[model samples]
Target: MFAIFKIFFGLGWVSFGGPAAHIGYFRNTFVEKLGWLRDEEYAQIVALSQFLPGPGSSQVGFAVGYQRAGLGGGIMAFLGFTLPSVILMLLLAVLSSQLTESSYFQNVVHGLKLLAVLVVADAAWGMYRNFCKSPLTVTLCIGTAIALLLFQSVASQVLVLVIAAAVGVRYLAHGNVTKDKPASATRSFSWLPLASFFVLLLTLPLVGTYSSSVQLFSDFYQAGSLVFGGGHVVLPLLQNIVGDQLTQDAFLTGYAAAQAVPGPMFTFATYIGYELMPSAPLLGAIIATLGVFVPGFLLLVGVLKNWQQLAAIPAVSGALVGVNAAVVGLLLSALYQPVFTSAVITPLDLCWVLLGALLMKQFKLPIVWMVICFAAAGFMAPSVANLI
Candidate 1:
């Protein structure tokens, strides 16, 4: 258990470049170095995470920890992997009053936002290739993107997913998509976790009426519950939640900070909570962080127990394909509206984005170094512009 915690804790400090990158790191450290899981076992875990609606990489980590040392180990793994980013986000929230007004700070933030743009673009393209290969799936992807681009509401997003699922069930269920093998250990089903998951999902909003803290928790929990793709996909959902509470500049700044840090992007909740409840920043940060994560973990425990059976069903498998394509579309829509619009302000900004994406793809530069270099460039760009 201690060894598990120590390894994940070290990873928390350097695991940048989002979910796909995190998966690669896990495969290298756990599978290649430690020989903890076979290649097929690791692949199954990732497939499980992809089918679920939450932070995929974090789910992968938790599942690995659970494999290592039961539920306590899973909880410890989460704490270890998320500690660095959560702390940094909380600190940024506290300092936003000063940071919001600094031009140099704005420059640094601009660069990080560009980084987000590049990251999301990469994610969308990869998902499109993997999940949207067939013509029917491709149509669902494009249609969902167009729908969300027009409506830009959570309701519309949910509707697209539902429609896509229905379409998949009607069309793709009998196709050749592979299903992960079920664990013998999980053959016996348990209902308590699934029951609790729904109870919380339904009851939290009503419970929140009596307490502001509960309301905050409920909102984040709902966001986490509904998110499909993973950490980066949480952006638009969260932006809506905090839009009334924070200035656009401050929210974007926090987002930039999230990208600069080295853990799950969900830790951005720490920044939101601290900013929202300055009188009790630590408490707020804890509540927000836990709120966003609890639903995902609960769902993970509930769904994985029955995943094998469900995946075996043709209709369900087809629906999942559709859902996956729709998720890519949702990310694509988000990339255009808020992420692209907010980040790219000048021709030079576009150049920076293209350059960053190229470096990330070709050179495979460490994300932390890329962030630092781009930030420095942003900080000096205005002076350079004047000289030119």
Candidate 2:
């Protein structure tokens, strides 16, 4: 248990660029570095998680633990993997105001922002290439993106997602999917712990912690539950919340801070936490941090209980292809809002993006190296400022 927590928490500390990037980290650490799983095993699990509804990385973590140990290891692994993110987000959430004001800090923020764009793009493309089984699947992806942009309501967007799923399932049922061997399904063995966690969360309101502190907690908790895709997946939902209530500067600052951090951008929970619920800043931060990841842990356990049935679903896999294609669109949208909005201050900054994207696509340069080098360029360039 301790080992699971330590490794995953360590992953939380080092994960940068967002969910897609974190997936890379998971593959490297668990499959390549530790030899915990074969490459095929890791790929199969990723295919499964991307097929499901919850956060992909957390699901992967649970799958790993479940593969190794029973329910106990799975639970420990889930919690451990998420702990570093929870702690970092809470701390940063408490200190968001200070970080936003510093101009020198913006360089690192912009650098991280660029990498996020590339990572999301790469992930979406890979998924689309591998899983987009038909033109209808392609249409579903395009349609989802258009619907999300056209209608701003969360309820409406969810309906579109469901529609996409239905379309995918129909496509799969009609098409062919044959496998030689069946995957193992996980059974429920830890309902007690699951129920206990739920009870604690459910009764928080009755416990009388419902101050501004609790409000922040509630907001991020709701955010965790509602968000789909991965970390980038959470952004549109966040925009709906932050863009309306907070100052543009506050929003931008918090966003910038999120990029510099090593863990998931879900830690943006911290930034919004401090701004939305200022009283008991640290406590607000803590709530926000934990709240964002709560869904990941819960869903990991929930999904593992029915593991094989999920991975075996052809429609689910098809829908994942569509969703991943949609993810590409989401990241493209992100390029303008968070990446370009802040980073393209100077004409010279444009060079950094072009170079960074080229490096990733053409030469296949490492993202971390791109972040470090480009950040230096942003600082050293004398004329760098908002291009517009």
Candidate 3:
């Protein structure tokens, strides 16, 4: 358990690019490379994580943790994956009051925006490899990708995903269900865990009034439970929750600061917690961190018990395959909205985007360095202001 915590705790610190990148990172490090799990099992977890309510990356972190240790392992993994960014974000929130003037901070933020685009692109590529294996999948991936790029909303893309899956299931798969073993439901729950989770979830909104600690906890916990897309999508929502009700300038500044950092955006929530109420920053910070991350853990465990049921349905399985393909499309849409839209403000910027893409796919450059170079260049360029 300790080892699990240490390793995953370390992962939390470094894992970047939101949930899709995190998923790719897990697949590469744990599945394809470490041989810790079979591909099919990993896909099962990926599919299972999607059905949960929070960020997909958060759920993946929980499942990876569970796979390594069980309940304890899962908890450690989430802590590990989340702790780094949370600490960094909290520190950033503290620092934002002063750090806005730092050139280093600005440059880093500039680089990060570029890096985030690259990271998301890499994530899309990985998803494509997994989901674009069949013609039906390709159609869903491409069609949804186009639709999302046009409409440009996560909710819209989810609608497209559901509709596409339904059509694909009824027509493409001929309404056939996948045949499998007669699966029985998991008898894994204790009433205590379920009851406690519901009770906490129901009352989370009422928490922050007691103290800043309560406020921080409630804010993050609520976000952890409610966010549905992935880590990136959580950004604007988190900003609204922490920033709007707190200090607008400080929250926005911290968000900018988080962009400059090298880890997960979820960590940014920690920064919001610490900065918003610093009279007792430690308690607020700790509580806020736990509150946001705990939902991710619960979401994973809750979904895992039902994963076998999804695996059992052939029609549902086919629909899932379509949905998984749509996930790739959804990612592509995300790339366009922020990545391409922000980065391609000029011809020079387009060159950089193409260069960065080539470096990633053709030369296989390290994402950290690729992001850094382009971001620096972009920040230095005369057109940088136009892009930002």
lDDT tens digits by residue: candidate 1, 34-137: 89986545655665676667788899899888778877888888888899789778777778747656788777667766776776686667667778889998
Model 2 worst lDDT run, 10 consecutive residues: 180-189
Sorted by lDDT, highest first, which candidate order results?
A: 1, 3, 2
**Candidate 3 per-residue lDDT over residues 1-388, each given as its tens digit:** 8877776665565454456556766775567556877655676677566656665776776787787778887877777776777767766665665776677556545544555566667667766887688787888889988987778655775688787668657754543444443244444433455566677787866765776566667778778877766666677778777645577776667666655554456666667666556677766667766776677666567657566565556666667677777777876876777655654566666666677778867998764466557657755765555656
Give candidate 2's TM-score. Answer: 0.66
C-alpha local distance difference test of each model: 0.77, 0.61, 0.66
**What's the C-alpha lDDT at position 4 in model 2?**
72
Candidate closest to the true structure, highest TM-score: 3
Total clashes in model 1, counting residue pairs 3 or more apart in sequence or in different chains: 0
Q: Model 2, 295: alpha-carbon shift in Å?
A: 4.0
Q: Candidates' TM-scores?
A: 0.69, 0.66, 0.80
Task: For model 3, state the Cα shift of residue 294 in Å.
Answer: 1.6
lDDT of 2 by residue, 1-388 (tens): 7787777776766566555566666765676568898754565566456545456667777788877776677777767766666665555555656755666666555665555555555555554454455677667656665665666454654566556556656654433455521343334334654574466456654643556556556556666766665666676667775666778777766676666777666667766766676556666666777777776566556655555455455665555444544544443443445445545665566676777779877997654476676667656555554432
- The residue pairs in collision within model 1 are none
- Clash statistics: count for each candidate: 0, 5, 10
For this target, which candidate reaches the highest lDDT against the unseen true structure? 1
